[model samples]
Target: MTASREIRLAARPVGEPAPQHFELVETTVPEPEEGQIVVRNTWMSVDPYMRERMDDVESYLPPFQLGAPMDGSAVGEVVASRSAGVPVGATVVHFLGWREYAVMDAAAATVVDTALAPAEAYLGALGTTGLTAYAALTEVAPVRQGDVVLVSAAAGAVGSIAGQLARKLGATRVIGSAGGPLKARKLVEEFGYDAAIDYRAGSLAAQLAEAAPDGVDVYVDHVGGDHLVAAIDALRHGGRIALVGAISTYNATSPVPGPSNLFSLAAKDANLRGMLINSYFHLFPEWIGKAAGWLADGSLHTELTVAEGIAQAPAAFLDMMRGGNVGKMLVRL
Candidate 1:
């Protein structure tokens, strides 16, 4: 039997998850069935949404069961395959992450070309991360020509890609919000953002006002709580806002309050809509076609904060939750 190590939820977290909440275990890898494949995982993703799954609550995604292996996006090479379509030596993307190996049905694993980009890219830019930015800007809050765009969590995986996409979609001015001064400066120097807001430095509303003096025409919100309220306060007439995530409230022990300035959106004829990326699966092909080209030509810039080995997966996740990563956070197994 092939031995593998995987991370399991040791306990359901009440507020913030720590190393004690996760336990790494060594176990035998299951053999592939008739239509299943065994993949030796190379790279795994650590995302903010996974933290929500740790809580045993009703949400878009089911809660992670206690004492079982946790799963998310992972890319690996097929070492054993019982399916004809997925042969041995093929690399595929699957959702059986947090482990050194994964055994799943061939249908669940997607075959991607590594020649276009590296395997880890499938976990970030060329995968759901890029799609989230694309769908939000197009389907949810559609950026318009000459519009002023503001993106919160601007140094994160999704928010990092969002700034450039807004400009490409015809937004003349782009503003980004990140936690630190270094990341805030990178938003302009690296990601092509016109203005950067250091959300950690001071008041968000005041900084947002200074960034977009004419008022924001579109807002791609990744950090909810205060960021949502600030965006609403800075909204222009007919402004559009896409609620992608609420990292701010994920670990809240008490019930978080709603935006105080929601009525202002109605007064300004603005639109505020929430988006879940699974609903936008149809845009994958379109996004890959454009994003792949942009990445090759240096238009779409991406960075990675990788933690080596399965043992560090839990620590990597904890750091990412606290905004330690500048871009996509991944674990190399």
Candidate 2:
């Protein structure tokens, strides 16, 4: 029998998860039951939202049980399949956490074509990241022609795609805010943003004013706190704010504070809408179609920062939370 290595939550992390919070253990691979497949994980995603799972709080999704393998999106190759529908050599995407191998029901995994993109891309760009951007732009924060769109975490997986989607949707200006100057430059030069602001620089309000002279019509917020506050201050009348994530406050041990300038929303007559991607899973196919079209036509770009091995997954995750990643963060096992 083959042995597989897996990472499990050893304890609830108080702040950022350290090596002690996770324990790596090896176990014998289990036999695949009927209608199930045994997959060998090739890539795993490490996202900011995973930080929230470490806490024992009531969330849209259940928190990770102590001593259980931490769950997230992953792409793997089916090594053995007992079901007729799932072929042995097919690459698939599933919510199978962090493990070298896993045995799951065929129905729980979706077959993905490796020919379309790299296997890791299934866990990133072509997968949830792209879908999230498409949904948030088209459904959550709809933008019209000549609209000014501002995106936070601008060089990140969802933010980068969201800015591009806004531009494709006919936004006159696509402005983005990233943590560093390099990332800000990449946002303008590589991702096709009309203008990009470095939030790490001078006053956020001043930077935003220079980037978006008229006013922001739609704000795709990924990094909350000051970024959200700045976006609110720069919004035009009737602007829409898509609350995608709050990476800035994800690692805070204390109670995280909301945007201090929230009253600006009422003054601007803006709408702030919270978005949970899982709640809109039923509409994924539609969003995927539009995103695929943009990707195929060269209107959308997918970026990634891949860590070499699963051993580095935790560091990669911590790095992402600390603003060390340029795009989707993943571990290539």
Candidate 3:
């Protein structure tokens, strides 16, 4: 038997997740069955959406089962394969993560061309994270030429790309909101944002108004609550807002309140739309075609905050939740 290590949910967290909520256990990966492949995971992703999944709620994704291995996006090289379609040396991206090895049906894994980008990139910039940014601006909100755009959590995986992509999509001005002064500075200096607002500095509504005095034509909301309310108030007439994520309210033990100024959307004839990347998976090819070229030409830039080994995955996830990461938070196994 091939010895492997996997992380299981030891307990559900009532509030913010702690290390006790996870358990690293040694296990075994069995031989692949017909139409299956065994992969040694090289990289895995830790995202904000995962916090919601840890709860026992009926959300977009199923809650993590106690005593069961937690799973998410991962990139790995196939070590053994019973399916001819996926060769033994193929590099694939799949949903089984939080472990050193994964055994799953070949159909569940998509063969990724490492020549176009690194395998680990598929978990961040070239994978769902990047796709979320592209789909948010192009389909969900569709940034118009000369439009003023605002992205919350601008230093994050999706926001970092979204800001740069907004400029490429013809936005005349781009504003970003981050938790700290350092991240706020990076938003303007590195991520191509014309202005940056440090939410930690207080008075979010005032800061947003100062950044986009004319009004925000399009907004990508990653942090819900106050950020959503602020965006609603500063929205231009007939503006568009894409509800991509709500990292702010993910760990609440009680029901979180809605944005107080949500009625402004109706007054301004604005559109507030919620988006899920899974719904736009069909556009992956179109995004990669453009994004890959942008990366090669240095038009698009991405950063990674990496944690080494499977044992560090839980701590990495907790740190990511607390905004300890600059970009995509990854665990290198």
Candidate 4:
């Protein structure tokens, strides 16, 4: 038997999950079945989307059950295996995170090549984060040459990549939004954005207009609500908007209303499309190929906010929710 430490949902949060909402418990893991393997997780991801799963509400994915081990993206080395294909010592990526060790089916664990990038990259830019950015820019709001792009939550894992990808995909200029001046500066200095708006400073509408006087041709929305309204107000005729996330309302207790200026979609002859990454998994092969090359050639860069130890996962998650992290937040075991 293997003793594993795991984080469980102790209680459903009302708003802004605190450390009390989670509990760390120890459990013994039995040997895996004939087609399963035991992975000792080295790195795990803590994301904003996990907050929505804490609520007992209907959404694209099911909510986390109370007092049970919660899961997300994790990268680990297989310590024990019952299948010959996934032998011990193979590094794998799986959905069983928030725990130090996990027993996963062979089919569910993907063997990623560590030679291309570090193991943790699978959880950040080289993994779902990169895929979401690529699909959103290329498909959701295809950027043409000379297009002016705006991205909200522009310092996060997905937004960090989206801003750069937009430029590479042919946007003439890219503007990003972050909560602080430092992050806003990072968008311009590191990720290659034309301008970075400090959303916490003042009016997003006024700032966006100043950033792009001619009007934005594409908007990749991550922080919805006011950001959505602002993007709609700043969009040019025949503009496109990709509704990727709504981090601003993730912790709201009451039902949050969407942008009131939705009518502007018709008035400005613009298009708004929602994105669910699962629907675009088919594009991963192509995205990975291109992203990997870009990364090797120094055209792409990744940032991470690491939380040491499995016990600190809850704190790390809370910090990320409060916009304490500049990029991807990970718990290193």
**What are the Cα lDDT values of the candidates?**
0.94, 0.86, 0.94, 0.92
Give a tens-digit lDDT track for model 3, residues 1-333. Answer: 999999999999999999999999999999999999999999999989888888898988999999999999999999999999999999999999999999999999999999998898898879999999999999999999999999999999999999999999999999999999999989988899999999999899899888888899999999999899989989999999999999999889899989878887898999999998889999999999999898888888889999999999999999999999998999999
Model 3: worst 10 consecutive residues (lDDT sum): 294-303
RMSD of 3: 0.8
Task: Report clash pairs, candidate 1.
Answer: none
Whole-structure CA lDDT of model 1: 0.94
Candidate 4 regions exceeding 4 Å error are: none
Candidate 1 lDDT, tens digit per residue, 1-333? 999999999999899988899999999998888999999999999999999999989999999999999999999999999999999999999999999999999999999999999999999999999999999999999999999999999989999999999999999999999999899999999988999999889998899889898899999988898999999989999999999999999999999999878898889999999999999989999999999999999999999999999999999999999999988999999
lDDT at 25 for candidate 4? 99
C-alpha-based local distance difference test score of model 3: 0.94
Task: Give the local distance difference test score of model 2.
Answer: 0.86
